[model samples]
Target: MGRWVLVAVAPAELVLIALLAAGVEVPAGVRATLGLLMIAVLLVEAGRWSRGYRRGRRRGLGRRAAATVAAAELVPPPVTTALRWEARVWTGLVRGLGRRPDIPPGAAAFTHHRAMRAVRWTFVGVLVVEVAAVHLLVPAGALRVTLLLVGLYSLVWVVGYVLGAGPVRPHLVTADRVVLRCGLTTRIEVPLAALADARPVRRSRDRTASRQLAGRTLHLVDNGGTSLDLDLRSAVTVPLPRGRSAEVDALRVWVDDAQAMARQVRAAAGIGPGAPAELPPGR
Candidate 1:
């Protein structure tokens, strides 16, 4: 009930706010009614969320875990995902600035190759120029200000991507799992026990989807290509954007040193050099 109310009211509130931001004059009574409706809806939702949190606690969940579960249950999945992604972007910006990769203890970090460097920098440069043009050419108004703000926000995301996909967030081979990441957007963690085989394979550059699913294979491409592939014993759930997931029996990713990554994963999974490889069916 609360979720439905929020879904219905949130968009109306946003539209109203946007109109006000764009200097549209709204009638006082209509604005007051919408404001009161939003407040009432929020209060009801807060009560429900509180109850959910308490229920989780009563079931012995930790505070953070309970809070997370409550939020997951109460909030719409798309909103939750967007909030999570935004948090990751800002966090990545900070970590990238510090030049720190999120490698856990006893994990081996393998950086992705700088295959997208030229493309990333070119895109950022274009965004900077666009922002400058907006500031200089557009008349001083709310719409111009909105465009400028959006442009600057986009620039921040590009910087975050450049740093996050570089040294700050590398492919990780840990004792128990293989953590594959594409900047702040996608992550896939496969347990070492589930790893069937690892190998270096070249993918064509014409295939431009950063994350693609074909049959039972999930491709995590970089610069339009992938350099390493991992075959799993069975299909595992791979999370996607907008609260979606895919069950994939294989994963293809790009890394700086494909050979090293394959070797490390093989070694960690206790697969001998002569072990039979059970490759997934062709894509």
Candidate 2:
């Protein structure tokens, strides 16, 4: 749990207790209305996210690829799990302090969808402005406006969560060459001879805490694009080996074994070394 939430709990509890002492009551109808509102908000947001994901898939996703992406979108952030674990540890620590400590709720990872994060934040800023205006200039009707703002925030918040949970599928295929299909827009082939190296890119929230990270990475100029243009994070790279056999290594072993067979065919036909080999054309 965050420090801010923990600190607020004490005052929030005290405020509730004071309200009870003063005979303040919240109507049951209002509680039911809020519950229904939240349910509606979640369903609408989920629908919108599903629609966008489907459109991406329908344009060209493979069956297995579509399923993989769908599943990622469905799960909540893993940080939420970490926050729950944090709560259990803190509970035990505070138990030894003599005071009866109330336990704090765990934190959950909430993600903003890749494309929607900007729009969501902008909506939040607008809500903040509306809230400020209501409180400062129209205080008499602020209660209703505040409730309306809360409902709108809840709707947008669920949209952000759905985007965070949406599916992501990246392709890595190993054949005679390496083939990578990204999103619906790119198709890449890397000849093994031109491949220079493969290593994992290490990622950490704080750089100093971890020394080593591992994942697949490949380095090759490819038919086009720089090494930086490819998704190297969680990717692998293979560099061409050096020696007298380098050219043959790229043509026969790296590009395709069929190229070697075609070379043999050309030699048998009394063709010179300068002849174009009957190898499959590059895409």
Instruction: Provide the TM-score for each candidate, comma-separated.
Output: 0.81, 0.21
| Per-residue lDDT of model 2, residues 1-283, tens digit only | 2223323443455555454555668566754655565555556546655665686589788766765565445444454344443444444234423333221233111111233346655775776666566556655553555555665655444433322222111222233334432221223455433332232222222222111122232222211211121221122333222211111112111111223333333333333556333332331
Per-candidate local distance difference test: 0.84, 0.37
Tally clashing residue pairs in candidate 1: 1
Model 1: pairs clashing at backbone N, Cα or C within 3 Å: 113-256
Candidate 2 segments whose C-alpha is farther than 4 A from its true place: 1-27, 67-208, 212-283
- Best by the TM-score measure: 1
Rate residue 58 of model 2 by lDDT.
Answer: 95
Model 2: residue 77 alpha-carbon error in angstroms: 6.9
- Mark the 10 consecutive residues where model 2 has the least summed lDDT: 243-252
Q: Where in model 1 is the C-alpha error above 4 Å?
A: 7-25, 62-64, 183-185, 232-237, 240-249, 270-283
Name the weakest run of 10 consecutive residues (lDDT summed) in model 1. Answer: 274-283
